[model samples]
Target chain A: MTALTLHAPILLVALPLLGAFATPLVGKLGKGARNTLIGLIVLAVAGLAAMLAIDVFGSGGIPTVYELGGGTFTFPLSGGQVPVRILFEVDGMSAFMGLITALIALTGAFFSFSYWKERSGGNLYFSLFLMLIAGVFGMVLTGDMFNFFVFLEITSIAAASMVGFRVWLKQSQEAGFKVMAMYTLSGLFVLLAIGLLYGQYGHLNIAVLARSIQGSLTDMVALGLLLTGLAMKAGAVPMHMWAPDAYGESPAPMSAVLVVNSQASLYGLFRILFTLFGASISTGTVGWILIVLALLTIFVGVTMALIQSDLKRLVAFGAVSQIGYMLLGVGVGMAVIATRPEYGLVAMQGGIFHMINDAACVGLLFFASGVVIRAAGTRDLNQMGGLGHRMKWTSIFFAIGAVALAGVPPFNGFASKFLIYEAAFKLNPFLAVLAVLSSIMLLAVFVKAFQAAFLGPRSNTSAHVSDPSLGMMLPMAALVLVVIVFGLFPGFFVDHIVTPAAKALWLGRDAYINAVLGG
Target chain B: MNIGNLPFIVAALLVVLGLYTFLFKRNLIKLVIGITLIETGVNLFLVTLGYRTGGISPIYTFAPEAQQMVLPTPQALTLTSIVIGLATTALLLSFAVFVHRHYGTLDVRKVKELKG
Candidate 1:
């Protein structure tokens, strides 16, 4: 491998982190310059991440593990299973998540120039935005459990500030506070779990610790804590009370990245489940717990969305429910892996694939809602009507996002949800039925929203409404392309990306251990 | 089962109590205190786990009297957690101050604006 490819793993994280700190300095140049700089930084990171992903996906599915600050001289004395320095392990799953995160951050940054240009705290906004993005990359890329905890805290702090950015608004501040409490409390639980593992195993490296864990009572309790904490962070019910508000309160660009933030927690959940404990976990019982929670998250998330009149709040609830499909798919896979490995693999692929697909679909929806909120200068669906007459391009964008989010045919959501249904059907008929039903309800929910916001007589006060600037339209169009392309080529995506991602988690234990141990 | 485990049990209860207050308390200040409590408890748990009876500090001193040293990694971890805990508490308390300034109340229920 060339040095650039060899170094892409660390560059993927450090570049954004350095850019985060550099943003305030850059902001002094000009708002336009600052936005352009942040966008370029994200684009660079995305390019590096994509390169790393292509190399990994093309390298016979072998993961690229980079040890930070470790040359032969620095750690030549190290001979144990646990590597002492911080490490970035980019398997198919991590690479995939990183790629999507950079993509969302890129679009979010692209859309931010227009949204945040005249707004206050432009410097603080870009700095915090970059920090949030960097935190996600750190969270997804790290190999040490303690490093994960630190990055989790980093992300939550940035997220809390971003959520409450509009402190003049009572709801925004309150949402920030509520999310802070939940995220901090949840974060403590993660730290406690990390401590428990460290106290027992005397190592922080995940692969090393996983190899040594014996599934004792302490391990069981640690797993329980990790599951609850990460699940809560992922917005799984009944701990999902913070999600809708956090999403609803944040500005549009932040909300787009926030989608991926929650997905990072979900990625952590899956990583811990199938990688750290896959070799020794009692899959049936643990998987059952996840499944039950998944069911609750889905049903309640959709029902809640159906009742919401606030445009952003409605989309937020819908985002929560989409997380359930991912959980259910993977949870089902986990439940049956001990018996039917083949079906489990298929289900796992569907679940992992849905992460990226959900990022695209929900991301598009959130961005479009931001556009509508901008043109109309209000977020209430009741205050909106006949936007199509004024904002033709944005209405079309919303229509595309709406149908794709509802899992209609020729959209990305359908392909993954279809795989989820078919694979989950082989495991249990009711789960599949429930998946289909919730999807239908999702369709109904968005259809009602579209009708409320776009299809009626144009509001007399909304002579001001017009199509969004090129900033917003371009991102939505980009997502529309993603949805259409991925939808049409589901088989190819499954074969190339999703399967490797599933295997990285499903069959990662031994290879991960051997790599960390330098065997 | 032994005297050594007493601090561990107390630490666990302290965590539970902290979470209870953080989740159930009406006052925002109490919620902040709750996080501090959990941080203290977790730090105690880490320190306790790392302690070795009749052992000295793990510092790199050349004192002839030193024989055995306690495990230092958990101590380092706890210190890092404590620092992070301090930063979060500062940020959260600042957020609470802003909320109170804007809404004219410190009660969480009173500040509920963006409801689902």
Candidate 2:
């Protein structure tokens, strides 16, 4: 209702933008002071974003659109009117994503305080970190497709550069190259698709395109292109080759960001499917494609993780598998849209709920792996042994994360996976059965990681491993607490954030068209 | 002969050609060139979308001349897309330089430290 709340979306990017530049300038004044300031800035932005998300949820299903300069009006032309302005629209979906992105970014930035010190170019790290956060904010908040492409590039370049933080290492550089190539190629696909859409409709605004499109061959082509490109970003199988190596090579803090980044891509896919192409496209075909892809992603990702000797690579593969679960939920939702319209809501709820939990669980796993790498100075499970007694906090955190990822009871991961199974089973028990099989593989893989890294005899040849600094430990601890809290009280988050997001996604097409083109 | 259908087919062929060159090329610089060519095809298609039979540029210096304007939105979007393409091309080229310095070769096949 107020001006401050109206500009909430832009503030998500600007706060970080200002901080990225401020960190180095402030660092010039002192060493410790700069980190403290950066941490404070991250916490501030995250807190503000949380507040805005709450406001949006309380406002019911009405989406808030804020024009870049101010004052929104319709431009009359002949017999029609169109909106010509840069706008930020915060609906249930965008706010939910904003909350997830800001929360994870806050934790990562705070964790980096002690984790990145004594390394040269800390300022550079913070700058790139903020830019990455800003890019995500832009991606979720912007309504324009071309602008979305730009933000995707920003996220890609910053992430790829960060993946090779250890620029001197040959493995790191190679991993960086693979990730960069894949991300750029994906972006190019998205750009081409957007161009195709633009040529057909003469509108790049997503909301407008949604209304004007009505089940044409061009629409189908655009849909295919969009799905392929977004699938690559989400690390879907046949296009997910870069995920494991990139996650393995990046620093822990950045790896956490990458997990969340891929989740954002999934969210983008959901937005396109439900919000952009919902009316024009049939759910049956889209749902089948997603279900098959999700199945392959889970089966392949976990089987590959099982054979991995490197701890970071193992965690990376785990991330790929977790993405499958989220897709399963979304795919189930898509399948039920026409056949069982009454159960559509439940399927969507399951999918969106899984999205939030998977971000937390997979993010925690990557962070813990970073801690393991930091302590042992290697990610090889064979080189690691009983550091459980020495690094008690790290071990416990890793165990919590591992259990959550395996979808055990009394974890946030289980709550969502249970919902997904119920919904997916109702639609097709076979999908539900495959999901269970995938879950078992994930459990076995993590148990192996624990046994190899924490339960074996302590290797004297390995360096003396200790827990990360308190600054780093604090974020992991916070994540552990969230997993426990959300696991215990899943309904609160589900009812408030995920439920409304599902509604907006499933039935808000007309509202979207009205906001963009003004009939 | 409808003029609208012509540009679309041409653009599609150019994109296919660009992809072929990119996939087959061994040199990093040549790969980048392939990407640029593909972008050019996309951009040209975008500009052509705004075209009308007798429409002029969207810019109207005189108030009375506004009725003859072509659709300006696609043109604006294309300009933005082109600029983005330029930035990507620049970044990829610099990355190629980094690759050259590290591996002592511009061939992507020679870079194997990341392969399974």
Candidate 3:
């Protein structure tokens, strides 16, 4: 147990990476061997993530730091003034994000098992999938800025390839190109920011930089680049032009994984805001900036979703909107952080809790939609009627996902959004009103989709539609179960998991810095 | 203008030019070139960050004692960025090829099949 805990952080990232490369070689054996190998790798990753989360959360939010190249874990490296060796820092927040990634990756892998049965290049597909997962894990766990950029690029390349994996489809190619271009542009923005910071501080270690940051004009410039780049990746409005294309065009299971990838970038954004530049910047200005972006994202995402005739695109827009809720929640928290307002902690908890809830809700929706698209042979909602007649299990799963995502009561979405709304109301009633209106609009949008695709008279196109095999159904069912369980026990989860994760960001900065640099 | 800051000025100009080409040019291949240009600018900036006017290479094995050495980290960072840039550019160009094959044109304006 000690050994596993000691190595779990690195193992969480390295195992999937190694498995990705080993997949093609294992593919030479047989499909059964390949599937089993991928399944085992995902399961092992989930187990490690779970163990690490338990360790971090149980330790009362002290981060677990692992040094590479077998040196002492403390910073200032024996005789050096600045820490140069690479390290992995797993705090409550990182562990929380890891658990979310593991859950979605596990389900996405399982769902892809049957989804990819008829598809060629299954080996390559799983390989890229594993690479994407590894990249996300690394992004959330790495303690260095350059390492984060490298992981960001890895996710970008793997994800873009997967988006265009259907080389035969013209739309897929177009989406792939646009997404890759945007991802590359954003990544360069990040690299340039890292360069600026390194030129000033002569160190790439995040904790060291955070300790040394003085918020000069150069620092603010770097901040602007980091913010714009990560927000673009996270699908914030005005910079979110590529999201619908990437999400709507990719394979269904890949869409769910892509949502998690965006959230990983979102994680990076928060890390920068709270931990790295926490004390240096004017929190109120930056917090209000996030709030404004959140409002725009929510309004635009829902309204656009309402008009989308393509079922996946509608869900994709909905996914983008959910990013707004998280931003609003965390933005409220950040706005009030300096004052230490009572509601600030609550708001942070809401935002952090919403992340896992959104993952499950969105993942279920995408998986269910994948099944629908597969059965009906079309993505057009108008052309996909009466699927509920035959696809009984999928209909139930889709309904659960839709209701949960729309923030309906007694589902996970409402539980988290309730916290956000209450806190936002306390902060400013106007913000709460806008959030509620958007939630209502989101509900209406999903309702229209549900009616158009599943609740109508049988069309000729859906005559052959039926429930997918247990393989795919199980993953969706698992997510449905998560939605219900999280909804029913929101307080339990908030106290145990979400609070620690939130506090790690809201109030754990000193511990984080000290863990690396020592007191 | 200060001579020492010239590299910085050139890097910023390169980035601006790349953005101009990326935003203004219609050809998909040209867009790829634009991206590469931006990448080159960033790489140059990273390399320049570590340069010291009279410092020797960072290799300590054969160096004269008690002399200044340019920072090795930024150079290392530049090399990694270049490799990553190559991969990104290769991927972008391949996607362009596929797009041209399917759409029969490389014009960005022509690839409107995905928009609302």
Off by over 4 Å in 1: A73-81, B1-3, B61-66
Worst 10 residues of 1 chain A by lDDT: A72-81
Taking chain B only, the TM-score of every model is: 0.91, 0.88, 0.96
Residue pairs clashing, model 1: none
The model with the greatest TM-score is: 3
Quote the lDDT for A150 in model 1: 86
lDDT of 2 by residue, A365-457 (tens): 878887777777777898878877678888899889888877898999888888888888888899889888888888999999988777767
TM-scores of the candidates in the order shown: 0.97, 0.94, 0.98
Q: List runs of model 2 lying over 4 Å from the truth.
A: A21-27, A74-80, A461-463, A515-519, B1-10, B53-55, B62-67
As for model 3, its CA RMSD to the true structure in angstroms is 1.5
TM-score evaluated only on chain B, model 1 = 0.91
Model 1 lDDT tens row, A277-318 = 776789998888888999899999999999999999999999
lDDT for each candidate structure: 0.85, 0.80, 0.93
Q: How well does candidate 3 score on lDDT at residue A381? A: 87
When summed lDDT is taken over every stretch of 10 residues in candidate 2 chain A, the lowest stretch is: A74-83
Per-residue C-alpha lDDT of model 3 across residues A1-519, encoded as one tens digit per residue = 397997898898899999999999999998999999999999999999999999999998888888777555444233335666888888899999999999999999999999999889999899999999999999999889999999999999999998997899999999999999999999999999999999999899988898899999999999999999999999999888799999999999999999999999999999999999988999999999999999999999999999999999999999999999999999999999988679999999999999999999999999998888888888998777888889888888998999998899999999999999999999899999999999999999988888888887877877887899999989999999999999999999999999999999999888888788876
Indicate whether candidate 1 or candidate 2 has the larger DockQ. Answer: 1
Q: Write the per-residue lDDT of candidate 2 for residues B6-99, one digit (tens) a residue.
A: 8878877888888887899988888888787787778777877788867767776763644666788778878877887776677667667777
